[model samples]
Target: MSTQRKIVFDAIGSVTTEQYDDPHAALEPGQVRVAAKYIGICGSDLHVLAGGHPFAQPPTVPGHEICAEVTEVGPEVEGVEVGDHVVVDPIMACGHCRACLAGRYNLCEPPMVAGFRAPGFGRTSQVVPARNLHIAPRDLPWQVLAFAEPATCARHCVGRLPESARENVLVIGAGTIGLSVIQALRIMGAGQITSVDLDPTKRQLAATLGADRTFAPGELDPAETFTGVIDVVAAQATLTEACTRVVAGGTVVVMGVPSGPREIPLPSMQRFERDLVSSGMYVPSDFADAIAWLADGRFDAARLVTDVFSLEDAPKAYARAQEPDSIKVLISLSD
Candidate 1:
């Protein structure tokens, strides 16, 4: 057996690379071993590293957004073969749960995310269930495939809004998810798309990605409103603006995960018949749509990727990801 390297968040302020005995000596049935080509650092991973993630804390392996190549296949695993490029859907759910039975497994009871609730894909090579792998176009760059996970999240968020509410959309927070939401909206044929972010660099990227307009924190007119509002920054101020700025009877989709409970004015929402909904991780269909979009050139994943670091520079990658101007930071495990 050989050794493999993996990154671990040993404590709130520490990130270290450690070696472990290769686990591919034997593969469990229905599992496949994949060599990670690229892994995207997600906001949730940073949250866990900062000791603010509600579920996952320090002493956890932090990686979920990944693009990998299959190296070995276990018994009973079909449809996936070695030498295939794939993206991973990290949601792990028990088939018996009501949410799973209804095909809404993203909301499974005791929701378990692979990188958080279970072992993650941060290692150079790891074994995952074959079912979670979605084959991607071999011709596409591995960096683009790394976006499959986050793009699925944007797909799910846009899917929550009705077609009528999509004509004019307002997206708050032009971060990775926000920029992704802009692209998803464009692919869905939205009428006019506007994005707001404090960072000028992100605002520029949002416009380049497909947002028809971009605004700073206070640049948008207070009286102007939209048919739909997507809050990618679930802070109290942004949430309040989303709820209040949406037109009556319109919808407000919350895509950002808050650190703690937030106060929403239910009475006003009820009085105005405004629907405030939220989107969780994503479903299999959403993941498929994200992959298809990336394959067909609908979603441009390359624009959002701003920084890349080698596996040994995991700490540097995480630090760059937190920078105000950096959009998406990736760790490359292979060529």
Candidate 2:
């Protein structure tokens, strides 16, 4: 059998193409094969290439942000069919695990995401459990449909907030996740939402995506303003700053991940008893919410994309996406 071409990286940040045996075997009665339309390169993929991520894997096909057309469906798959456009949920959890039973599958014991451990979408095709597929709205572009997985993460954050606290929200960072937070807030009836980011491009993108106000972190007033604040950057310093910048009675949501070991003065932030809620990964419900929100035509999210590169150019796309002002990078396979 011939092999397929896949992009893999070395330990020192070098990218190379490798040929593994062709994987055209039919799904084992319950799997789905998706023909790649496009996949988004995540920051973690770049971190893995740069040897900065904890879950680094060299000689691995890296792409979890995937959108595609269903090329084949297993016998048990009742809904998905050939030629049906869909997005991958990308959460490969062991169904028998306790966390999976409780619906907190992201915390599945022996956690595995296909793009990280199994074959990924940085190739012509990939297969996963049909449960991982989320049907995209027929009206949404296939490019944006690729975001359903991350949209799930964003929906998870919004789900954590009180329904009444949707108005006058503050979102920190202008990356894809931040923009997702903005979209969620707007959908829930937030009257005036604000976003803060150092990158002007992302801030502008946030504004275009329904953020009522966009400000550089340096330009925000530290007067304990805003009813709710979401820190998606996950930097200790940035989160600390976000914590301090929010109003006393407000809720501070930390979805951004940061490196190990950081300090924050608890006494300094005790003035108004701010609610510090830390969030982890998503559940199936969050992803369902994300798909439903994507189906909603309230906002124009195509502006979130700034670049689309072919799988052959995955390395360069990963490199350039690290630019200070870059928003999101898409990797196209069918085009």
Candidate 3:
């Protein structure tokens, strides 16, 4: 039921780790226990480590981008069982809430998010709701399977747009989120995808993954105004420039979320004329499609995984992601 491990915090800038009781709570009727195989080092995880974001109160287990295999299942868990491979969908919500009824569970007021908002599977073992699990692709590696969550989020955003939306797309930020959005677009058959970021490492990775074109920071503004542009850079400075790039009557997906109030220009409102639509978290339909795409070999999930480290070095992994140039990085929990 309980175990001990080092709990680290502010881990992006300085070392913050300790041995604490990492518990594997009991499974509910619709739950399963998983032996975590891969725990990705994401920007949000680094936000906690660097003291830059408000994900958790610190001294908490730090992993949300996770992939694992089911080791146990509750009696009511029918679709999955022991020895089955699966990926965890970490959102926890109350079914009675209005948002839940509307199928917008991510906006649940009393939200229970895994990793940050609740207990997650990054530790040695964890019990999660069966509804939160999907049978993992037998052929996919744990490292690549871990992207299911973010990729699901991006796919949900793409699905919301009109079916007639342009095939040419632009993604700002070559970070994991940006790259994940690009991958999701590929799953949907978007004809061309362009990625832009200041970091060459990220751009290069974007090109490797699927981006048809990669542009430098300021170098991207000159490219064709996109029918759809995703803004993963949430800072006011980044948002302002991104807004300028969204074409009129086009769709600009604002996936970037930054902390604190932002400064905005009145001129930025003109982009709304471009039919701005915002999206959040994974919707069920979106997750399903992304998972199927992963299983379908439409894109190479395995190739996206560029770096892996031991759980003990998780803090270092976060540090590397925050570096000037960092690609997809993950943590292997097994000894």
lDDT of 2 by residue, 224-256 (tens): 477778888877877787677666666778888
lDDT string for model 1 (1-335, tens) is: 87888989999967888888884568989999999999999888988899987788889888999999999999999999899999988888886888899999898878778779878889989888898889988998888889899999999999998888998999999989999999999998889999999988888888999999999998999999999999998999999999988998999999998867888888889999889999999998998999999999899989888999998999999989888788889999874
Task: Please name the candidate that would achieve the greatest lDDT relative to the true structure.
Answer: 1
Query: TM-scores of all models?
Result: 0.97, 0.90, 0.87
When 1 and 2 are scored with TM-score, the better candidate is 1
Model 2, TM vs. native: 0.90
Checking candidate 2 for backbone clashes, the offending pairs are: 224-247, 234-256
Tens-digit lDDT track of model 3 for 1-335: 45645335533456444455745666678878778887776677767665666657555667776778788888687878787877777778886788989988788875677767787446767777888777866787666677677778778777765544547787888776788788778767787888988888778888988899998977765655767777788777666665666666667677887676765444555645766667777766666777777776665556656678777886677667776565667777756
* Model 2 segments more than 4 A misplaced: 1-3, 267-273
Candidate 2 vs candidate 3: which has greater lDDT? Answer: 2
Error of 2 at 304 (Å): 0.8
Q: Between 2 and 3, whose TM-score is larger? A: 2
For model 2, state the Cα shift of residue 259 in Å.
Answer: 1.4
Q: Determine which window of 10 residues in candidate 3 has minimal summed lDDT.
A: 4-13
Of 1 and 3, the candidate ahead on TM-score is 1
Computed on alpha carbons, the lDDT of every model, listed in order, comes to: 0.90, 0.76, 0.71
